[model samples]
Target: MIVTAKQASSHCGGHPAMNSAKPTLPAQILSQTPSTSSITDRLWRHSLYNVLDQQPLDRVNVLGDNSHGHLSCVNTLSWTPDGQMLLSGGDDRTIWRMDPDYDVDYPFVCKSVIQTGHKANIFNAHLLPHSTRIVSVAGDNQVRVFEAAAALAHSQSEPETTYSIDQLDCRVLRCHTNRVKRIVTEDSPDLFLTVAEDGSVRQHDLRVSHTCGPGGSCPAPLIKCQHELSALALSPLSPYQFVVAGESPYGYLFDRRNTGRSFDEEWGSLPPTSGPSIATCVRRFGRKTKPRDDVYGTHITGARMSSHNGHEVLLSYSGDAVYLYSTRDNPQDEDEHHGSSIIPSSQEHRTDVIPIASDESHIDVQLAETNDNEASSPLQRATADQGDLDGSDSDDLTLDAMPWDDPSVPIILPRRRFAGAGNVETVKDVNFLGPEDEFVTSGSDDGNFFIWHKATGELHGIYEGDGSVVNVIEGHPFLPLIAISGIDSTVKLFAPVNHRSEFSRIDKQEDIIRSNSRGSGQLMTRGQLALIRAALSGQELSEGNPCNVQ
Candidate 1:
């Protein structure tokens, strides 16, 4: 997050470029073109998603495999305000913090197992709507609240450090009746939601004086939906409007002020079923209405919205396929989470809310420091960094393949801090890409970069790729560039080639469109021609002899 120049290189042992003097903005905004573009980093063979960012991007962040301790898969990721530290949760049922400091000889190498409470794979980890405290859910059917003070409060000298993720671990909040598949926060820090495998969704209000703190009882949820909830998220645009992903392959979006059952329950909800391969339940976000109608019950295995960006767009990823839709168009299924609901008690359905408490202090102490050296290093350094693959090839000989090629990785979860009208965007299982507005990008199982349209569900541009799937994709906000990790074991940067001259193409396209449009048809198909004339009519493009043909 904080990029500095080589002010004092010797004093800080880091890559020369690592010490950037300062984040320098271009004297003039640059232009972008498909051909004449500039790219910065390439995470080859590391690409896990098939999505990518727009022009002028930077590899501001990078998260590697476990350095503190190894985990099966990374299921959740969250960023700090400064964008410096990244938090993650996964199948290992462990949580961690990743600080990408290029100055350090090795990054992600200096990590801490962090919260050590959940007994099973951590289904989700998140920061409260407006505060620093994080909430994590697990398959163990428990939910725990972890305040930041507790994480940074660790002192090996203290008694808490005795437990380790690898050794005798304990610590974490466990308050749920079934496997917590996912969790999400609402507009107020006190308000949040979590879904479990037990076919239910619980809404929690810190104000609810439940014994969470002598704070009375965490009020019985304002609502409860009896559908088996899988994934959960609060709409970035309108906080009250939230989304939930479930086991039925479809998710739901309902206004907090609306009905008792969530969209998932109303649409021929499925009976709780068990499976080994169903990691996706149903997730949705993005509040901006779209130009078209999204057929109800869109069976999206996975969905994510763009952060801070204005277009309330969401992407849905199914298997090898991906679909993009806007919040407006998907109205039939566009219900709001006014609150949660409760199903009446029945012989088979009657279940008591089971709450368990784990010793989190223990998981943190034992996980200790990273056991291996620089495991974060590229696969090329295999001699020093071996495992996962058994070939005797040296690290240098091993190509960093695209991470998305594998069916295991997840669609990075979006952030909850940003508040604005968002365009709903969804993608089923398109390997890479998180739910941020501007800096978000994704790589597909097929080799291509699905650059998002700033705030809309449109494609900014497309980047061809290697034969393997594409995954690891990221972008920096301060600079005009991005990086992608692919199956080729390489990271590629996409930058603007002719920063100044590329603007010329925009003018060229406008001119071409002005020469073609005669009238608006029954349904105006969005295109270059429509946009050019619209801009000209609005007098926003400039007065003189418009985009000159010559």
Candidate 2:
């Protein structure tokens, strides 16, 4: 079912609006004179309404323990359906349900903590919609569902309750062979989707028994990508469609209906088969400037479909800038136009396809050999062509001079490009912000949240979030508040407030972009980066007692 804005707003509490009630003046003023009191009350009410209409874009609160909350970095933050609490998962193999209580000095308070019984770090976690169950994925290559009703009930009765996986009713599904990277829930609480580094995308149904699968395991994957998968996003407009991105530079759109099973049919089937029923790729998204042979440092870190516009998709690329793409045509029409799978195969000669934003930009892709002797990296070469880092020189190669610039080369570019955010060393998530999803926001390796105007691609604002890298930036379901987390143990909250301490704004956009471009070429492993981060944090380490950097 297509989810409308009104339905979404209703699901969350309705968005804050102006109260029609007139403000009451002080008793002393009311007793002194009726005319003065009446004018003062109307003016106060008008002023309050104006403030509520403005955007809430200021850092207001930090949520975590005074010493340290999670022993490691927090990876993800998700808001509950009612927007009353936030669910956060981290490398410490723990999930905290926090209440943003404005009544206290420390507004963000952890009401409960769930110790996930995973063998490794927790990657992502979320409270499923229309249900009280919480689904989580971690480095253990398994999906776990926690019956959170009891835990949540305990927390409401007595705050700060701690529950172990064994203490609560839970189910674990061993489906993936490698680390699971992401999970997304559907409209129905029974169905959900997960993607892993094993290159498998699988759908799970809580109502089905797994006895039919091989060795009594979960069902087979619907899509086995050639590249390791990292991110997944379900379309709000289309129930059976979703998008997936990974180590490859491009994002692939797939339709589950192509498997010959409708949503209703899949739900009605009592026993599921063990055989794999794969979906079809409908479209591919990528930049026109990307090189044919160079896939290094081009892996997508995050992919999100805009709730305000399903035709638009936002992507964050490691060692690069954020991009916004517009799927200009219907999925069925594009599927027929492309007429073939965009998946990479072992064949030496194959057609490379990309989504065309408009009819005027249509182009066919032909295989072309890249120069192996080029010393500079793809990022450096692209930046150098614009000019020197200082923006002065001109003799560099132009887009028309590039090998992929031929008329036969298939190329599609992004609708908007947002720069000035550092994404060189970490896997960061990008998202749309504001009540209407009017702004694009992402966290940087520099520990700051960067926002840009979605329509114009102009930098809007930047706020400090964490001490190291800010990996996640999630907007409130209906309100203007935002929750951000990173290498730090705490989650920082941003909202519109009348009073805030003065902070510096970044004015060196070109410098940040250049630095990110240089760092992208010198990438480091996650383990290595973790070690450096620990050292910078002044943690004590020894040969036998090393920090759990994972």
Candidate 3:
């Protein structure tokens, strides 16, 4: 069962109970008592101790309001390396640095606000690791860098004061021709990467002017994809390897070392003699067919590498489902010619647009088959074939031996499918939670966030996060805390509290999965999304309102 703030408060009379007290390690467990269990068993036991403590029902603080907080929907929420400060970017074109441990009546308070000069919505903003510098991207197709200290210094007298882009030390880099979707930092503090709707993945070097290449001439991108990209994930274990997915049914893994000059550099330019810059591996989950214009369930919204297991990946599909896959197996073992670089052919470029059922009937049939083959227990089911979980198939392909034009590359299936999370209405984020990264969590369009056991794929908890939709689910770097934001103007922080009841697990899995699949037919256009943002910001729609369908 999902619990909201109003329902929780009503359960304890008219007054809401004080639920800010944090949980502590039991004395017996802290004493290091001898146990016969193996090291792995003990470690797993300890990690799962308070894994479900962070619940949205017990909201510790709400960080936005009409007067001081963001006037629009908060799109991104991230924590500094030190975990002392939280940063949030929104449609309001502002980035706010928040202190979650403030001493005032409210625990979370906006310490500083950077009013960016981007002509469009701020998609993402994050502080550079171990530095005061901040990087942000927006729909204006520009990447901006500013100093957090400068924003704070300017707002010292008035915490709620907004620091305009001109007043603060900032650098605006106009690199991509289209809107930038995501930006990620590498191990180097001076290096960062961005993917844009222009189908280019470019790397930026902070040490140089114009960020990449030389002077002001248009620098070539590292990799120019055939389709517009929306998601990018750098592998935690390999510095040169990353995953890029968007507008496509598959996620491509590429190595930066193998990248050649941008395809846009010269028309009909031949690939390097060494090899074409192509994905080393490709991952496909769900049905192998092209989605119709009305249903974009196959396009990837986000991709993330597991913090603990680099070979493991989590992908969230637009208006569809979430999947977890492993890339540990070598495709070369199956075929001698695997892993060779071949130019994509025209035939390979054309994806088969296989039509599917219009409603939940198809999903019901898939779910029924899944239940028929269920394992004896949750643990056994997790180890069993993952294809049945989402009622969708999975495949992994190594691209070395096949030409890019080949319709078939390779096929490894996903290890797990996180079910019952509805993501049909909005773009949501999926992430791993807990100290050991033992739990998988995602924001849903139903205004609640869902949590699953990382290893078992069991639906563990579902907590109400927003009144409309929950889009971002960011866990604190070290602490047992979670920060969530979506259509609501405020960012909600969740932490463990004693008064909250244990999380209610879903018993009827089929019902929830069916509910999640029911809305797959509805399509949310870009104009509709903008209207939602405008309504949240209390702004009147005018001739300037975006009307394009995504």
Candidate 4:
């Protein structure tokens, strides 16, 4: 599985002595040409040889009950800290633990099922770090933290369904007033954050009892918003900062250091001590078409802190796009500001604060319609340069925002329309993969998981799923594996082709072969690229058009 350059050269007969003879320039070109013109540098760099050589992936096994998985869409998945087992929950209102290392013959069976005390569909589930405990939030508007069951002892008898209620204790915390959308944990297992459809963000301490008062007042939210909040992500590096994106196009950043004030009071011209609001700085993405339309009005499905940069965020929109945004140039960047800094405004702030659009033609119309005062609104004060279409800022835009038409906004770079093959049109969430965050992955409505190179936006290849709309996908923090779920009742696991090929083989011939016309054959799990490289360097290449190295 570990391929080295020396091995590749040896397989190709690429010894220095082989090329010592001075050959004609034309012969050299012919010798170096690849037989498959489609093989380009984009395919080979930073990925496995099988993937680079266009070998399609094979499904090793399915995880479910009686060959059928979750009864409803498996909306979310998370891995145990050890990565040996996974925690999956969704519309089924039940959570289950799956062992990725189970034998191929019984690969799909659940190790145990947690009888989530949830009355409605489960939205997300997470295994607490360094413990045999798990916490889940769902449409029932409750957060339940419970101890997970021990692994079933090996037996000659068939495995029995283990229940959370029988083996472990459970604590249900009534925090949010509406359906909880997402939950994120930081350094402490007892302290975590949750966001709800009611547009409220609350922090809960497990040590505190929910029923402190006679009427049983719910946990107080650290911040509240008017718009329905769909997603929330706490910064991994900074303990006090977090970001929330929702139906509105603007993604707001909050600092716990300055809690107890509303966003408007802190960022707006209102007094700093304004009542009942969370004072925070907000960043807007995209532009409004009409004068009165909400600025950066696109609904954001999800947002997360970038592992690469603490100040940057990855946001998924309601449309077929995602944006990597930087918040380095806030008006509140003064040293005195302990929390979210405010972006200072001026006379030029309005006319210069243009929306990031892809089409240049709209620039003229946008400029014409935008007046000096219009650009100076509270939202325009914090316009960080819309990094180029790829979301990488060129030298940093103190105030320059990128146009919406830029190519880097979507899952694919260079601006290609999404070829979604299933019932869903928009992705619900996306996350970075690997320790370096080398790739970005999202679940598609078409029941497939899509992965793209983070830097170049190159299509890494699709992971197939059962025929159901996939809503959420997450990567193991350190492993090469990914867990995805959607309308199907089961959560599916995917790993690199090389790794899966070593574990199991599907007996059905049709399942072994990829349906895609290109690279349609049994995929090579090991070092097949050395053979391809050897063939290209030897005299076996086609004689025609050697000069065309593209």
Residue range 355-405, candidate 2, lDDT tens digits:
222332232222234436442553344333222211222122111111111
For each candidate in the order shown, give its overall lDDT on alpha carbons: 0.36, 0.61, 0.59, 0.49
Looking at candidate 3, what is the lDDT of residue 25?
A: 25
TM, every model:
0.46, 0.71, 0.71, 0.60
**lDDT (10s digit) by residue, model 4, range 290-339:** 22322332466777776546665666655334555455644333231112
Across 37-87, the per-residue lDDT of candidate 3 in tens digits comes to 368644644464464544333555566555557777888887775555678
> Which pairs of residues have clashing backbones in candidate 3?
339-400, 339-401, 340-400, 340-401, 344-404, 344-405, 345-405, 396-411, 396-412, 397-410
Backbone clash total, candidate 3: 10
| Model 4, global lDDT | 0.49
RMSD of each: 22.9, 13.6, 10.8, 20.2
lDDT of 3: 0.59
In terms of TM-score, which candidate is stronger, 1 or 3? Answer: 3
Q: What tens digits encode model 1's per-residue C-alpha lDDT throughout 327-445?
A: 44322231222111111122212111112214322221111123344444321221221221122222212121111112121112111111111111222222224333442345544
In candidate 3, how many Å is residue 120 off?
0.8
TM-score of 1: 0.46
TM-score of 3: 0.71
